[model samples]
Target: MTEIPAVENAITIRDLVVDYGTRRILDGINLDIPAGQIMVIMGGSGAGKSTLLRCILGLKKPTSGSINILGTEVNGVRARDMHALRKQMGVAFQGGALFSSMSVAENIQLPLREHTRLDETTIEIMTRIKLDMVNMLPHEHLMPAELSGGMTKRTALARAIIMDPKLLFFDEPSSGLDPSTSAELDELIIMLKNSMRMTIIVITHELDSVFKIADHIAVIGEGRILETGTPEQIRASTNLEVQDLLHRKARETVVDADAHLRRLVGEEE
Candidate 1:
């Protein structure tokens, strides 16, 4: 018998809680995301998925517990140190959040300019490289408003990876796209994971996306994690909430006239 190598975790959250006034948005979240793996946070609407992402990004302070990312405590870090810590992450917002005023190339170059002392020519080369990575090199001169929804999303992804951060966070990567387009995005995500070897945490509810790309998933409900497992594990889970959630989308309709009639007659009686 051979012992398996121990995997290193990129993120660790223990007893995490977040409160907005009296409302508890996240309650005692405990999660571990292994290094260089694509982990997904999934749930229905208002399930605190985004809150958990924000907490991990250090945008929101935890009321209790700890969030350790790349061996640094997120909540307790100093402001200057926190800024440095944040540089290790790349985030893609839900709406593609690109600057309407800037060309795709300019938008991608923004982070490089801010963070690096590289000359203009070097930044241009780096920007083009990232755009090429996302297959948006041809659209470099186009502005956000000039691109299609899918292209805009790809451009946002290009900008996200321009700095080559250690961690990548995506908010609803497949939102507002047709099934085929969504699937395309899924393929792109898979390619990014393999090529970049960076830890990825995506907040999404798209089942197709989840099944396609998630190495592990944390299902959130009522501001807490209901379960965390691989797609196969989640599909075979006995937890009713998990079952209902995973199956509801695929449930078929069956006529039950006799049952309906019985209930109606019982009510009359």
Candidate 2:
């Protein structure tokens, strides 16, 4: 019999916890995001999805447990080392989060300028390369305020990849967009994973996007990870929380006669 090879993990979190005042936002999250794959974190509002990402990025301190990225322990890592760790990550926030005052090229060049000793000409070339990667080469001169929502998101993506970071984080990539635009972003995300070989962690509640792009999913509910698996595994999971989330149906409901009649008749026909 042949044995299958184990996959390498890029980000690992064990027994992670985050508390704000008296409330615990993330009770205990244990997740292993595989290298070079896109992992989607899904949950309802206030489920601590964003909190987990912040902790991993070292923006928030974890109350307990451990987080390791690219084989380095994040907790108590020195300031200089943490800065280096941060350079390995690029984040696209819920909004485009681009600088309104800077043109697209300038925004994308910010990381390169701050992190690298590359010459101005080299930085300019790299900026163009990143913009091209996100299919925003023609909009390099546009300000964030001037671009449409989808264009803004793509420009933000260009900035995120400007440094060629090993890991990328996206917060609510499809939020506040029409369905078609959101779908296009999903395709772009898939392209990034396939072409760049970067590890990606996306915090999202959009089910369509999740199914379309997630190589694996971690489902959080009430401050804990309820389940983690591939999309098919998640769909077939018998876990009550996972089932409720995937179906988006309340446990029980009493409908009015007219609505119930319409639903039943429509189903029968």
Candidate 3:
């Protein structure tokens, strides 16, 4: 009998917590994303999904817990070490976050130019290659203002992959797009995972895209991880919060009467 190989994690998060003033954003998050796979972190609005992403990216300092990305501990990592770690990671923000002033090619080439000492011709060639990979080669000279929503997304994706990052993080990738465009982006994400062999972490609430692209799904609610599993497992989850999120049903607010009264009387500050 042949034995299966052990899976390697591209990221490991343990007891992750984040807070703003007195509001605890993330309670305790423990997650592991396997190498060369797509993991989708999903939740409703204010569920701490974005906060978790920020912590993993080393953008926001967590109140406690550990975040290890690409085998390097992110918490309390030195500035220069964190900078080095970022070279192995790529992020596509919710709004594409492309500069309105730069053309598509220039936007895609920005990372290489900033991080490397490659010649101008080499940078141009690399930029075109990335643009071609995202099917935006023909629009390389087009500025961000001239691009449509789908085009803007593709350009951002092109830029994200320019450095061939080991890990790719996409925030709300399917947001604000028509169904067709969103589906196209979904396909592109899978293709990137297959072709680049990079671990991809997507933060989204779009059920369709989540099911389509995720190898694993972590459902979060009220600053807690409600469940984590494959799409089928998630669909079959018994947890009410997970089911509500999956079925698009509104969650009932369970108000604590005493706490509510205390806050109303300014006694629980």
Candidate 4:
């Protein structure tokens, strides 16, 4: 058997907690994502996967604990410093969150235009390079609404990698794609990891994609992690919650049906 090589830790979290008023979204979470590897976070709907992604992206401040990305503590970094940190990161939003008013070339050029003093010729060259990398160069003149679902995703990815960010995040990469398109996106993800040497974090409940691309996976449930391990380890996990999520089975559908109905009827305290 061949032994896998270990990489340095790229993102580390300790005792992470997030809350909304009295409702807790993440509870005492801890994780370490290694450099130059793909880490997928999988969970059922409302299982706090998106909240955790937001916390990791510095979009939402956690209620407590630490998130260290590329050696900088992210809990309360100054705005100037946060802006600097963001320049090193990129996010591919779910549903291909491209600008409605911009062409593919324009959208991909937006970041380089805003962040760098690079001239038009250089910016256009960079945009073309990324568009080619994502196999979207042919559609650079198209608008967001004119692209297919997979094309939209690839275009969004082209924009994400335009700056060659050290850390890249993707949310629901294959959410609305057909099976073949989803597999193609999965291949593209693996190629990005192998060729770019980027520390990638993906948030998805898609089991097939998770098993296909994740070097390691963290299974989250109800604001907490049930297990974190390699794809094989996760597949072999005996934890009920992990199994439930992987098999798309609800863990507790009627645990409190009468109380839930009473609450809907305004009869509960």
Candidate 5:
């Protein structure tokens, strides 16, 4: 990442609200991610976790609120400024998102090629270093389809950090892997944080992965943050919804017959 003034928090979000047409997704969210810490955002399906990630990633605009990433407000930053700021960040998308046509080395080199004016030799050296970091150097010549799921994830991780991004984002890093593979990936995540000192934001609901890597965890539900704390605090939380989620218990929704009918008729607000 580019040299910038140091700050206590890498990301600060306040009164963030996002809506899609008539339905609200994120309602009144406030969060501060401390610098160089691993913050995990976990939630059940349709819990607005992904929506909030989008807002922070600058992929979508919110209905109302402010998002400060790396001390720069993202809502209306100048185009050039935003470009510069984004150079400090990187995202490892879900399912790897590697181009099927590109080799692993090529994929990792994409960012450097797009962002910098380095020569081919330096870019090649950088790409190889990243691949070695992720234990993917041996497979650098393979295409996306030729690699296993774990290999794919490792390659994506290498690409995310190839630029030495100040803030790194991971989406479902352990999603499709087996137990042992997941554990290995979790270890790599911690090792990277320790070695690189990059502030990482992981969006995942996997409990084992969460316990292993997260410095702090935020539980989101129903388009809002339900709780934010250390893993132990989250485990000890007294909130009914939190407990339900932690135990993987099915939510019991009591019926309001009249209100239900009204909602079905588009009458409930």
Candidate 6:
């Protein structure tokens, strides 16, 4: 019998919590994203999905708990250390956050220009390579406003990978696209995972894209992680919330008529 090697996680989060004033946005999140795999985090609106992403990306300071990315503790990490760690991470924002002033080629090369002292010729070559990878080489000279939504997303993805990051994060990758376009993007994501061997974390609520691209799925609800497993496991989940999410069923709410009337009348319980 052969022993299987233990899986290595690119990102490990434990008891992650985030708060805003007196309200808690995330509660006790514990997740391990395996290296070189695609992990999709899905949830209904206001379910703390975005909050978790922000915490992992070091944008939000968690009120408590720990986040380790690429073996460096993100929580309370030194500024210089976090800066270095960021060089190995890439993020594609929800809106394809491209600068309207820059051409596609220039946008893709921005990271190299900012971080490296490589010569112009090398930067141009790298930019071309990344653009080619995402099939946007022809549109390199086009402006952000001149491109279609799908093109804009591809350009953003090209920019994200130009530095060959070890970790890639996509926020709502399939948002605002037609089914055909979304499917194409899904294929591109899988290709990147296989070719680059990078750990990819995708935050989305689109079920089609989630099932198509995820190697693992983590479902979040009400500021907590409800479940995490493979797509099949998620589909077969017995959790009512998970089932409701899958089937687009609304969660049941038992409203107390007297309490509702009291609240409407500004009366205390």
Instruction: Show pairs that collide, candidate 5.
Output: none
For candidate 6, report its TM-score.
0.91
Give a tens-digit lDDT track for model 3, residues 187-207: 999999999999999999988
Q: Write down the lDDT of every candidate, Cα atoms only.
A: 0.88, 0.89, 0.91, 0.90, 0.90, 0.91
Candidate 2 backbone clash number = 0
Cα lDDT for residue 171, model 1?
91
Model 1 misplaced stretches (Cα beyond 4 Å): 251-269
Model 4 C-alpha lDDT per residue in residues 83-149, reported as the tens digit of each score = 9989989889998889999999999999998999999999999999999888889999999999999
Query: Candidate 4 — which residues are off by over 4 angstroms?
Result: 1-6, 249-269
Candidate with better lDDT, 3 vs 5: 3
After aligning candidate 2 to the native by TM-score, how far in Å is the CA of 242 from where it should be? 1.3
TM-score of 1: 0.91
Write candidate 1's Cα lDDT for 1-269 as tens digits.
Answer: 99998879999999998899999999999999999889999988888998888889888788898999999988779999888888889999999999999999999899888888999888988888888878889889998889988888888888888888889998999888888888988888888889888899888888889999999999998888899999899888888898887776444223367776787889534
Distance (Å) between predicted and true CA of 241, model 6?
0.6
> Which ranges in model 6 have alpha carbons more than 4 Å from their true place?
249-269
- TM for every model, in the order presented, reads 0.91, 0.91, 0.91, 0.90, 0.89, 0.91
For model 6, how does the per-residue alpha-carbon lDDT over 157-198 read when each residue is reduced to its tens digit? 999998999999999988889879889899999999999989
In angstroms, the error of model 2 at 27 is 1.1
**Candidate 4 to truth, TM:** 0.90
The true-versus-predicted C-alpha distance at residue 264 of model 5, in Å, is 32
Query: Where is model 6 poorest over a 10-residue stretch in terms of lDDT?
Result: 247-256
Q: Backbone clashes in each candidate structure, one number apiece?
A: 0, 0, 0, 0, 0, 0
lDDT of 3: 0.91
